[model samples]
Target chain A: MTNRTDFPPPNANQQAFPPPAAGNQVNAQNIQDALEKAVAPKVINTSNNKNDGLNKCPRCGSTEISTQPGTGMLVCHHCRYVFEVAVAVFKDPKELIGEAIGTGAGDITIDETQVTIKCQGCGAEVVVNIEGSMTSRCHWCRQVLSLENQMPNGAVPDVLLPFLLSRETAKQHIEAFAKKRTFYANSHFKREFTTENIIGVYLPYMVVDANVHCDIRGKAGDVVRKYTVGSGDNKKTYYDIDLYDIGRDFDLAIDNLTVEASTDKLNVNNKMNTNNIINSILPFDLENAVHYNGNYLKGFNSERRDTNINDLRGLVDAQVRDVARFKANSTATKYDGGIKWESQDMDTKGSQWLSAYLPVWLYSYMQVKGNGQKLLHYIAVNARTGETMGSVPVSIGRLLFVSSLIEVGLLFLVIIFFLFLVF
Target chain B: MEALFAQLLDSVDLTQVLAVFASSDEDGVGAVLLLLLGGPAFFMFTYMRYRNTDKRHRHEIETPAEMNNLQQYNNFIKHLTRQSSSTITGANDNVVSGSLLSNGGASKSFKAINDITKNFK
Candidate 1:
């Protein structure tokens, strides 16, 4: 396991950028200004504050002043003053910068203990730590700093959800999951079950919220068939179904629908990420999610949330459809047929992006076969509650027990069918 | 192919021909066979050729169990995730920059999330 203090081998051919200055920098005002900007980073063009900070062109204190991006500064058109954009100066060596990155998701300001990226719309400046935190954003900008390129080192994250539950936990989960498959599996696999390597990975996922309305219309009918062939002992019963003209409409709000976006590595959409165990470990009490802080990340390696807003669209739809189907279900015995969707009304209200380090205990073991290898990685326990979900590696002991019982059950079922048919 | 048959159908009355086929009469046998043979032969030949090619393929015969299973599973998931081939193109070269992101001491999202969720975002 890589220790926290050890930095990974940096890639060769990587371009190097300078770090921030060294000093006891104090500015309660700077801190407050940064703090306010952290939460409220956008300047309203029509609102009163639009002109609140609009003082005379500091160049000549001229009341008729305009602000625009100069080569490396915010140029006051009236006085032609060029003060470098000093706030939210990410990774660059200087706490101050010579230019403005623009009206992004937010404005960020630098501080000794943390870097605050303020959301332009909100006042929250996401503050991240230097050591373990691997992502950062203006708490206010809501625009993520971690997802972009060329961000300053250590300017990234404040906290991480470390890898916990170790390798042993994964072994147990895989063994249990495998037991159920032992009965009909090719059999050779059962005999050669050996856990040589279990690789642990923190898979990536994006959870979302959405409100949807659905309208469905369809034509359906009841089906019934009866056959009678008779000699004294050759009579048959009837098979029947009662269907209907079905129509349904439903409205639902789904929250935190998770999906994976990475092409390689561990994707939540991968078969390995089967959604079974992940779902079994779900309902992360997202409602209880607090403002993120590095302190809570004291012990955990977290994978960054690579999936952004765009990736969550389909995931949200799937989750919405799931609930929509359920909501459309009615206990009437007659409604069985295809339903066509005529229209779907959907909209998102107040989309707030959140970055939470979900907990998971993962264990992985790669097994080698004739000429290839298979990785048996397991998401063992619900990181938050330690609940065991499911497993893939079937234990020999479990296999013997399960298969023997299954074989006995099949034997009995066949016997019962034989008696009913032959007698 | 159905459309090709449909074009043959535009001027002709298929229902009348189908009615003769449905009669189960000795006199209609030849006409019924004539109507059914065309559609069935074209479809059956197409299916047989494809099935033969598939059976002759190398990978299905020689691929290892694990690799085959992984491939099948990946195909199933990409279908489920609804990721198109276009979305996957050029995905390899881009990587997130951890260093530049982690710079500026600490106002990044990792901290913001922790901070707000300290109370919950």
Candidate 2:
């Protein structure tokens, strides 16, 4: 067991729990203490309040800021000066000791949608409706004021991944994907399909890093001999098998396991909507994610993180166990007859959670009536990697007709072949 | 009456029936069966192709390729043979014991942190 003292201290911005007061001992009591403390919410202050009230260009103090497409720099429209945001740094997965959550990842303590900010330019109070936009202009000085501070209402996140793909590029990707499925697409959908409705949106996600240990005990079988018995029609084959008691013990360090933080996106009810289509475009380049800035969201729309770390704890544990099971199964390939896991255990030594705003270009269409159920279709493109996936409403009648025609054509060929053989 | 039945049976040609069947081999029977079932099979195949396009990604089932401190144990047990038609019983295959978090209700035996030193013992 690794000593708790040997690990480095927690970050200056992060709050460590339980104090590790028991020193280097690894006992049931220490483990229990850590578990109890881990459940208690601890926030990491990731807010940068240097330019809290106003997001201005350092060169000319201009608030007209927007992200440069396919780049990490924020360009000022007035001065044309570009400011580069530093990429956010996180603890290494292997070094993670206990639960450390960002302040933005905390639960929604307040339900206030409208926030009043005192504009530094004119000292006039301006109400910024955070539900609709994070930035609003002051009527007195016409100076732009943005919400740069972390809000307990879950509006701000620890980091944000700027959109790497332009709107035009995402539109092209979506159009090309839809064109391939146009043959079987619903007639109503095809007639109304347009790329002009596509929008650039920042989706909420929780990025996790975990250190886990897994133990598994199971029974496995291997085939030894195979033979057939009895006569023609009654013949049967059997196997002589060898069984074994298998066990695997290992440690895993998982890095950047992303899960949806929005409740609406996590609802994968295939009957209601094609929400999984949005999840398909995963594996964003999170390493390039910069510290959160409201200027990056000037033109894009974003969804707030409604789920807290406690809510996602169970999901994270399940996914970690799944990963551990997958690892253990890979080593049991020698078991030709397969293995049955009788005892499976996964112990998360430590985990770190951070909230993020991931970029996605989305195009949606609702099918009013299909099979007596309405389904909302989505075509999502990963704004960072250009990975495109979508669901297109299909015409069942046309599909059935085409399939039947092909089957009939094949049957005719088979009959002709039989006739030629007879002749 | 028995003489009339015997005369009717002898009138039917058995050689003609056997000759007709023999002319068409196993391939002919297979072709006929394909023609009978090919419609539904082809329709299902095309339908599944379209359905699969909508749900092409499976990130949940995928795991990372890296690991550390991996130890494996496999002890050989007794062998037994049975005269069964199927090779696999499939009774214990892929059965994961204990409670899982994704099983909807509360889990009883699952803990995020189990006995860590149990493996060392």
Candidate 3:
């Protein structure tokens, strides 16, 4: 079996990932030079396959490099040196935004689920399965193989947020959350709740940075006078509010606004799984995000982005408008009474889109209804920050019984008040 | 749509609705007060009841075999504020200058969000 090359053949029209520069200056041609610089000029892994691993230690030329768990750093066992992965950056952020908005999600149509790659280490023909795993091991040389370049099915992301929190830390957070939520949670859930069930996963997300122009027109209320009229049954409070037409215009630079890039986790209708709870744990530190490396995904489970940028355009637009409205409201907080925003328009000046894999620790429990309908309740903790949120399945009978008693007590108090007045 | 409108029109009974509210000790006023103040509390309780009833028979459960779950979302507003403050301060003027159409930066692109010139006396 012949060995595969390290990177895919460079596409003429595709954008390039800008390499780290001396002055941080970037242009389209510089980006191409950086891309070439990041991949080539040395040990060609003799493999012509696209899915072969590129984990060779650049220092000692040894293939014993592996990613250190909890930290995304690739450590070489042979040379005892750390290798830095190259992050892809564009020359102009504006061009990135234009491409994202102009091109729909169907940019690449990859029909094949697998790629044939011959291992450079042992000349063994290793079949890289894109459907499930990103990497494989050569049966002959026992060297780890990886998918080195961007795949057509969008398996490899532009960047990734590595897991910073250790397995022990994630376990502690999960255990604490389960213990705190055990009171109202289903009995079965409590019985099944164990720290052993918590697992680390890299979920797909789209990181968006934008320069937005927003215009908002609305009516705001300025309070003039307040007075109390009448008493007892005829008691009334009146306010004279002066209304004025208000408008605001501003340019906003938004960064690291993330959206779910996969459809399975984005599904809101799934009663069995609290998928929204998983979404609530976003806002990963995109600045700390590193260049995509297959070695970093060695031990963890990762989901590739199945959904496209076009599918989430409407959602991102709504979020942008929401942020714009919020910013406008900040300026008008002096109108404490309230402002009713009637019309809002947000125009995209420029934007950037990059796909990433964010880390998460998750534990879920399933509760079935009497009618055999199953619902999955999820408790998720941000693997990095240890912040926790979950949907706990609770007993309706107990809650209803308690609430009804309270309602009855309130009715009794009302009846007593009426009797006292009559007397 | 026609059927829905017809059904809604047929369901309206002003006198019957008034009588039900009037049955309360303080007449319709007490019912109105209850609706205005206690509606949310009652609705929350009803929602809990429904959720509780629905989850009584859940069966197969699946979760991760190892502890890898949730991460805290950073404050995005803080990031936005920092970036805009930099623009105002011209901190990244070089980068901004390189990107803008005429090297004028964000100033040329600014437009009033709510233009209220015509309505003023």
Least accurate 10 contiguous residues by lDDT in model 3 chain A: A1-10
**Every model's Cα RMSD, please?**
26.0, 12.9, 16.8
Report the lDDT tens digits of candidate 2 across residue range A164-280: 899889999999988988888889999999999998999999988788777777777788787876755555567787877777776677777787888788665444566767877
Give the alpha carbon lDDT tens digit for every residue of B1-121 in model 1: 3223223423344445555465434343445354444443333333222111111101111111110000000001111122211112222111211110111111122222223221101
Of the two candidates 1 and 3, the one with more favorable DockQ, higher being better, is 3
- Candidate 3 structure quality by residue, lDDT tens digits, A111-227: 566877778887878888776677888888888788866655767777776777878888877677666645445566667767787777788877666655555665665555566
A-chain TM-score of every model? 0.46, 0.87, 0.79
Pairs with backbone N, CA or C atoms under 3 Å apart (clashes), candidate 2: none
* Residue A349 CA displacement from its true place in model 3, Å: 2.1
List the candidates ranked by TM-score, beginning with the highest.
2, 3, 1
Give me the displacement of residue A69 in model 2, in angstroms: 1.4
Q: Per-residue lDDT for B1-121 in model 3, tens only?
A: 2123223323443334444454433434557446433433552444333222112100001100111111111111111111211112211111211110112101111012112111100
- Per-candidate TM-scores read 0.39, 0.79, 0.66
Q: After superposition, how far is residue A139 of candidate 2 from its true place, in Å?
A: 2.9
Q: Best candidate per TM-score, number?
A: 2
